[model samples]
Target: MATRPASDTQVLAGRPFPLGAHPEAGGVRFAVTSAVADAVEVCLIADDGSERRIELTERTFGVWHGLVPGVTPGQRYGYRVHGPYDPSRGLRCNPAKLLVDPYAYRVTGRLTNLHAAQGFVGDPARGPASTVDSLGSVPLSVVMSPGGPDTGAKPEVPFEESVIYEVHVKGFTEQHPFIPEALRGTYLGLAHPVSIEHLARLGVTTVELMPVHAFADEPSLIRAGRHNYWGYSPLGYFAPHPRYASEPGREVEEFRTMVAALHAANIEVIVDVVFNHTCEGGPDGPTLSLRGLDAPAYYLHTKRGHMADITGCGNTLDAGSPTVVRLVTDSLRYWTQELGVDGFRFDLASTLGRPRGGMFDRDSTMLTAITTDPVLSGCKLIAEPWDATGEGYRVGDFGAQWAEWNGRYRDTVRDFWRGVTGVRDLAFRLSGSSDLYDHNLRRPWQSVNFVTAHDGFTLRDLVSYNDKHNEDNGEDNRDGTNDNRSWNHGVEGETEDAAVLALRTRQARNLLATLLLSTGTPMLTAGDEMWRTQGGNNNAYCLDDETSWLDWTPSAASEPMLAFTRRLVRIRAESPALRQPEFFEGRTTVTGKPDLVWFRPDGEEFDEADWFDEDRRSLCLWIDGSNSQARNREGALVTDHSWLLVLHAGDEPLDVVLPSREYGETYKPTLDTSTADGTPAHPGVLEPKGRITVEARSLLLLRAPRDIVEGPQTP
Candidate 1:
């Protein structure tokens, strides 16, 4: 692939359909969408450090395109769109500042010099466009081939059976001792043998990796000497973040390799994506990719020309626009079809479903496009179903095809364990949040239930800290969430008292047990199984160092919690009743027993009176496996022993009376969260209607004998 002569570059009018730089046998054809630009030029940087500027003479519709007969794949380039710089009219284009392709597959370098990256070259305070050229300072897009060899088959785990482990790519392996020093904190590091072994041992079917898309640190964070460790601020939608790649120019391949490795281990890879906003902040922000190309069309703006801050981020992408929708859909297809991702978890997903300046609608253009798109509909889709704007807390409103992060489950469970709420809300969470998700013919698994996530406290810190400890995040500790429903067991922070440590450990187990055994798709934070803590920092989004990394060196408390979590997962896997595919309707089965039964501590059926009992800290749930509608590998109806799970969140142990023999004759204890091996103090079968002791702030699971025949009872 030789460089084309200036004459050929000047004369060739390229095809404009593909919308990015496409490498062909003769040369590369460049195309970009800039509806408002008067002129667009493709600035190609050669291997010899020389630059060639080719004005895209062809315009089909709103796209500017041209071809250079010799430019090949590996050539670096950027776009220079000539347009007005009027802010009030929402046009912020400046040809002086080099712009990245909105569909760039790979980008090199960072936006270190903000002033040079901004469209306004002079004093930003004066709000005027800069006349100086930014070709020397801004990062350039590297043209690359679009397709690759198939990296094996995806695991394609079903949502009902999937257990998601949300993890940060770099932070997950940053302190991993088993990973090689050079590979640690990179894409390759996540696919390391040790990382795979940990996930496999923990029994998670999917690894929901935090954002790996190319992102930039906020200028405010840069000035404060802090970085966005979570990678929520996206820079390039098509490219993997280069900082997470072990080697230069191999970010895409490295990401594909990671996905392949996880697939080989039968674990799916789901990435958390931020399409709600870009790193380009408010009106005073820099002009990088879409903002510079056409801010008015790319972002949702108020009538006064200010950005609609629906994401709490300074700017929100106009997902309703046809151009932005195409960009998003194309990017999703690239990741799933080309990069081999199993799924995606959209952050602030409600923002994507909002029509310009309107409320969030389930039938909004972007949401409907995604769920109906042939390429994307086949892949798993998860939504963080809310934004920071009006009516954004839509936990169960994202239709049946999409699963949601149940924020209500998190808050209710935390409140229950903290003794701030009664058994009513706790029962709802434990039963897969049926009240929230059951309206639209949704199954139990539509609720992705969890008590902790990346944006909140770790399971360990949740028990050790009463309030968020984020002073180190700067901004005088005002950045993170303050309403962290956490409870410190006697002490506020780290304590040396054995009694306090014991209570904290038990509370941690209680939370983990509830999360794994609950009737929904449970998601565990990466380090929660190993008792990882952020030093009480509920939000460590800014701390890229030790504060956010998982400490591989386990503590005394971590070992037991890890063992307990593994045992809980195993029990859940063995018991089909625990992970029911459908919502429990309380209908009487052929066995003369309800498919699901709820009881008070005294062995009586729970009535309306028991729900509002403020002092009630315990409840008993019986799940009938015989009522399951799932089929096994042999195409036979799946059935297992019925299970009775007793959960007590009180401060003292209590005697729980078992249900009558009408349900089953005898029960065998399977798991007790208070014990290291999930063993009960008195192991063995207990007669039906017998009393068993449940420990304080812990959960117990018992399996009913399969041989016991159902007795005659009234339906």
Candidate 2:
């Protein structure tokens, strides 16, 4: 050990109110929370790889605090928590393994030697503590400037008007030819004029970026020369992934600039956060930040000290513990205030509500803390709403404050287009799933509806492949989910058959139109609009090459698909009846017409029996947009145009009639998914009771003339 620092001058007692290392006027104030450690040493590392260890003598509550007089900003450091290494009690504090600061705003270095960072010597689950020093193997924390969170202005878009785009930071900009070579795959690349222009044109109000938090690839993958491309394994919450930054040692500024640019484009930034678990796998895994500091308080464990892996990620963070709750809440607040992000999408969110005993609770301590938080409560909160275990899947159980990724909507919509489901479940999904989210004062927007997300197949692949092709994942092609409800039109993978290709394009259009026109917030996956494909690899989470990156120069179908997607977005922006604030009741609206009425192909209202008929695949929705129940953001009443949406899933085309005079006076065709383009080249203007032929496996949207027309809206 290095010589002890002079307690009088070199080390001074510091406050422990805010954890993490913060550079002050003279030096840096270091504070870390650890309940089971006997002592904590702040190890400062020089450029030459030499470390000077200073023991923090003052202990307040569960936090250790000390101030070093000569510490400056950007100085590299870490902690060596000294305590018992008893695995039976779930305590694994080893001074040999240099632990990362839980609240580290920035972390540097790479994890090269997995075993060197492990705490145990023999059988990792139960063995003597290792004497090997991890200072040369693991990453170290860096001191950041002292400040409150960033107060940059946010778009603050309402859920009713938000169209979220889920994109990976690297994959989004990697293949863009217009972006400069140096800025490609960096934070500045996403914020560049070209990137912003694409998002603006797509009409996405918010960009829900996949994990940009500092992460580490699994040791098994590292040894195999593969990486966790999606970045689900988080190493540091506060630190933005340094790989995305264009300038070295300036990742914070670069991330802030990216947020500022997106906000300027009227788009909100929502980061996908992984607070349910850490990079540390299990008792047999390596000793990272939380695992090495105080495993009992940070992780949920069995009585024998083995991790209770509810997330199927080797270990589940104990959300029930106050220490863990504080860490999560503080991290959220820090990201919100300091980083200028508008919201968060919690990954495996069910684990956050499972306080104790591995059962999910809506009123868990963790949920309450975030809801009651002054800064975080106002920010948009989206939940994945599921975990790895069967009992952890708690969809539609989150409160009104949260919007969930509606897995049912995704499954039902896919099934409807694939001819596997009847119109009853499809109707419930299309009209804002009241059966699942009607309670808790939840509005229609609480369901963050999505047909294709980051975890599943892209929209292009969803129609081109009936099964997953994950052979390159090195998991024997058994890694991705087998429950993909997809259709290949006729042939699998890639083909030059024009008939099959045309049908595939139509199917893709049907899915996208359903998602955007549904009565909830819609999330579009990146590169879906450009007809990007992974060659049917539904689980391309490991292959980070061309298999994952968005190819701007994609198929010839790219132009039409991208144009159709933008048209759908514009149509949703112009029609409020399509994205209603309240559930449709089939009652009279302000126009003295039914708020929403389901009709048969013969222009008759759907009876109870028609809904459950398995053969019924065609349905027409007459939505009265004279919305008396809706109030704008300024608390003013707003009325939009009524719409007649016709959907047909059968193979043969059918003749459909418009509703009588009671529903509308005249209708103009706004969109037709059957056409090569989204709109018909020669549309026929007609009155009520007029007849038209609806093509198979297609959707048509006809708008009722609005006396008070609203212009095209953003997001």
- lDDT tens readout by residue for model 2, 1-715: 3433444456889899789998775999999988898999998888878888889888999899988898899899999999989888888999999988989998888788887898898886678999888888898898888553243678888788899999999999998999998888888999999999999999999999999899988887888988889999999999988888888877888888889899999999999999888989867788979998999898998988778888878889999999989989999998888898999999999999998546788889999899889999999999999999887787799987999999999999999999877899888888899988888989889999999998879998999898999999998888889999999998998999999989999999999999998998999999999999999999888888999999999567999999999999999887767887788776666557668889999999999999889988898988887753455777665677788899899998878999997778898888888876698633878789988888889898888776653433311
lDDT of 1 by residue, 154-267 (tens): 887768788999999999898888899999999899989999999999999999999988988888997787788899999899999998989999888889888888899999
Per-candidate RMSD vs. true structure? Answer: 2.9, 2.6
Candidates in order have lDDT scores of 0.85, 0.88
Model 1, residue 567: distance off in Å is: 1.0
Query: Looking at model 2, which ten-residue stretch has the lowest summed lDDT?
Result: 706-715
Best by TM-score: 2
Which segments of candidate 2 are over 4 A away from where they belong?
A: 1-9, 147-151, 709-715
Error of 1 at 216 (Å): 0.7
TM-score of each: 0.96, 0.97
